[model samples]
Target: MDLLALETPCLILDRGKLEKNISNMHKRMKTLGVNLRPHGKTAKNIDVLKMALEDQAGGITVSTLKEAEYYFSHNIIDIVYAVGIAPVKLDRVVALIKKGARIALILDSVEQVKFVAAKGQEYDVEIPVFIELDCDGHRSGVTLDDSLLLDIGNLLHNEEGVILNGVLTHAGESYNCKSVGEIRDMAETERAMAVKCSELLRKNGLPCPIVSVGSTPTANFAEDLTGVTEVRAGVFVFNDLVMAGLGVCDESDLALSVLTSIIGHQKRKRWVITDAGWMALSRDRGTASQKVDQGAGLVCNVEGQPLNDLIVSSTNQEHGIISNRMEKDIDWDSFEIGSMVRILPNHACATGAMYDRYYITDGSTDIIDIWYRINGW
Candidate 1:
């Protein structure tokens, strides 16, 4: 089926670009001599996961238990729930463990460790765990000098039903880096921090086997991965405006886009309106702080080539307003009402969550496959 024939405001994935992105990242990780545990949170589809797992160690990192269950059901069992686990969510984790899923939980608090241990004991499961570390203070995790690091490690290692698997940290601040050199520095810091925490654990007579660290920017620019066991990156699978703005990927490498049609025009305001609004494109303005601010998205022709200086300047719940950044008048005839266009998102993960499936294409209008995505939780 042709992509234009499908309903407007849908997701279109370029399979060729997607495959190239995955292959390149795999090669990069291989060169660094670290295992690639691709995060499933970005592309929540099993089809994408299968392609990413190639040459990997069969372990996946997920932000939610639903992703863990969905991927586990597809036989990709080695999993890491990368978010700080809540006491209430342990039952679901335990259920997956009992079903033969080697799921690892990450948390930074002693309270979480106690909860996990109690749940594991009650369920008779030896739950694997990773102590989350704060590499750059971007989000959750314990600091290197924080005494809680050893406290949690000791509790996890000595607990009855919990096994301290290792340490994990994400260099989320890499996204804020202004240059590739900055990203490289953040990558080194991320790797060094995780490795140091692991060393500290081992120094205290505890086993720290898995040392994980990653974020798309850090993963792509890391010059070394000396003691790191695995790298977890997700947005690399579908480069967005944010990744492009960060120089982690070129704009041409973006593989995910929203397909929409021109619905109306305001010649007075030089606005080209479309059915794809924030509801379809998402409200993530991740590129706003970057050098280039791609509004809602960068407008593209039907062939996926970016239009000259065009962008979705604004959006309502169900209407996207396309305009030129230079404030030039649009060639109305070239974008007549009902003419189809594609929008490259600012954040692939956020935009992807607005859709339920991907209309796969090999860089063409001809739709080749329909890949379903899991949402919620």
Candidate 2:
């Protein structure tokens, strides 16, 4: 297959690879017997989202209301805004709900519960609410031991227009695990925590129908998801250096990459300057703390194969400094002034977020299609 001439710094999605990654995630979730409600925040492209849900019940998790609106407009009715909502965001949620979108909102506090309940009444809409549980102190979720879980659940259950749909948590800390054993332990912890929370809600006579546990690391290694209804993982569709560093998915499984072209070079410094910079690739150095601190991203040839130890060592807003990861010698002529290069991102979601659309190809030089994305909050 011949490569197509494309604009520099465009986000590329390898179609063949994209399907393989989606299939792997769905297969894992099926074996564990849980619904694979993939997080759409990773690609933010409907083409990818459509493929991710094609083999399963269609439910997606989103990080922004704009995403909720975008997917809803595209006919994906079952959506979960995974991020906790501010009271002001209810109007946006309600507008979608009123138009036939089943958007679930997540929250963690009693104050948020009250705010959701109040907004539900004002809009006369039944807001499906998921209480966020803190599985490992990684993010915004409330801890399992907090009394507010019961308090918020009770309030939602008793409220006129609000329904306590379930509890969801992301074992984000699982990403930091150094071994498969540690990820396994964290996955068990994530499952146990959500199950225990479900038990607590049921014990309190509150309806807890859904138990959601997420984060790619925990989802991949979760030995038992017996009590969980659904698993939310986004990055698996476009594996990143961070996931590769954690052994969640290999760098070869990275379907999303930034398409760049060599613009200049510094021979003495062994740096190959490219048109892709922090703006093309995101500023998320997720692998910095990992054992392999991929400066910006791992560099690949135009065919998307790794260029030995080459990586985007540094970047300015519109320029990338690609060099050997170990800072060894470089053949400056190898990367000529107009040659194309592909840079795999440290974080797929963050990197993909930088572009408005993805140039889709199947490891070929020619573009299969261009898929648009919904960016922003």
Candidate 3:
């Protein structure tokens, strides 16, 4: 059961680091006076999810209905389908509702609202839903001043089968920040958006209660939660290079990494290829605008410590190019064929999605256990 003895090209999660991250996030949310509905999209592993839900009233945010089913089957309730629920998935959403799972779906447009309301009526169910607001308009969400909020609220409020629960916003822009202070500003801005949107709903006579905000970058640096009711941050459960770049967590706090072995060495190129590639690491070339560009990922020693002068540099399908800051000074023969190494990913969600199981370890780097992951649509 030694980790070093385990096969290469595996996923290893540090037990201590994982718990530290969980505890850190829990304390931060408590201090901010908001509910921490950790996002399950990052880890997705039952073991990791369980650690994330500690003393948190068992609420979670998932990107897919399958994840909802997986967590619900495990007895975790109070789920939020963070993504916009399409009409095709209404049946599944209805099924989860019937089973007493307190669920909510996101709506950003009038067309979507009408469709969801009609579906809810046909299913003879009261669908608790949240209106997705575009705080900074990073991706999918309605604008703060968009008249659609009140319009959709009024429509769903009067509907016999639909209930407008609250407003939800994700500070996805927070990830692009360069410093903890910048992340703090993003958090405040997210809270402000949630609060302001709630006010707009209330002014229009809609019973607005929940004000949810998410994104690990903001969650870690956010100082005040005066109006937010709940916070939904996922990657905090397993810190990644993306989070580390924003100073949300130390590089050492990262719990997951891609395990690879040296496959070939190009001494002249001053680089060594590993079995791990974009398939093992991910194609998430995260926020290259930052001071440090972690190509595909940061190269780490087998024990999960980043090699200061080394980086994955470049990656292609089924291959990774490892090189040091000064390629000329890089020692290629130092890493011969069969030498194992670990690469810390830029985005844990995307990278973790590439694997089917996690090779769990207690930081010994000599003993490892495998925790299978759920994949597919």
Candidate 4:
């Protein structure tokens, strides 16, 4: 069925773009000489996972345990619960391990280290772990020159049932880099930091096996991933307005979009009101601070071709104001009250989470497939 026949404010994924993105990422990882453990936070759909992994579940990363369980339930066992593992979640991780999930946990503080160690000992199962090394201080992770990494490594490896898996770092701040050169520098820093941590652990007589590092921007621009064993990136699967703004990927590479219908119009103000609102498109103004401020998202036609100079300027709970970014005259008659439009998201992970399922297409309106996504904690 066509998307026009379906309800508005729905999610649609272009299959061609999706495959191309996956293939491009795979190729990038291949050239980087690292295993591509694509993060599953974007599309929590098993179908999307299968495509991204090319049916080979080498290793995947999840931001939430629900995603870990969902992917594990689908028989994809190797996973890294990349979020900072709270002490209370040890039981859940143990349960997942009992069910044949080789789930690795991330740790930054010594408290987390001790807690995980205690749980690993109590459960009598080897808990694979990674030290979250800080790269550029974007988010969680120990400082680059942190002396505690040695202690954390020893705590994990020396303790019974706890195996220090390796060191992992993400230069998430790489997203803010101005040019490819800056992204490359960020990627190098990320690689160097992870490698340095792993080396430190090894020097301290700890078994540090995996040296993983990546962010969509860094992974794409990095030339030397020498010591990096694996790469983890999520947003590259579905390029967004932010990625396009950073010049990492083009608008054509964007796979996911919100299908909306023109419900109302403000002729005097030249605003085309859409059924899609912040609730559907998400409130992530990731591109707002960039060179191009694509208000909520770049506006597109029914078939997924982005409309020139059109953007969702403002949004209410259930309504979106689509206007000309150039502040030119609106195409009043073209977008009839019932005419449909597609909206490319700013951040794929945030925007895709709004919908439960995605309508799959190949740039055409044909709904070739429907994939359900896992949500919640």
Steric collisions counted per model: 0, 2, 4, 0
What candidate 1 gets wrong by more than 4 Å, as runs, is none
TM-score of each: 0.99, 0.97, 0.97, 0.98
Query: For residues 70-157, could you state the per-residue lDDT of candidate 3 as single tens digits?
Result: 9888888799999987889998999998998888999888888888888888989999999998887799888877788888888879
- Model 3: per-residue Cα lDDT at residue 367: 53
Q: Give the TM-score of candidate 2.
A: 0.97
Off by over 4 Å in 2: 1-4, 55-57
Model 1 reaches what TM-score against the true structure? 0.99
Q: Candidate 4: lDDT over CA atoms?
A: 0.89
TM-score of 4: 0.98
Q: Pick the candidate with the highest TM-score.
A: 1
lDDT of 1 at 72: 91
CA lDDT, every model vs. true structure: 0.95, 0.88, 0.85, 0.89
User: Can you write out model 4's per-residue Cα lDDT over 1-377, one digit (the tens) per residue?
Assistant: 88889898999999999999999999887876788898999999888888888647588999999999999999999999998999888899999999999999998888888888889889898999998989898988987577788878777877886788898898989878888889889988998888887877787778878998988999888999998899999899898989998889988999999999999989899899999999999999998889999999999999888889999999999999999998898978879999999999999999998989999997789999898897899
| Count of clashing pairs, candidate 4 | 0
| Order of quality (lDDT) | 1, 4, 2, 3
For model 1 the local lDDT of residue 255 reads: 99
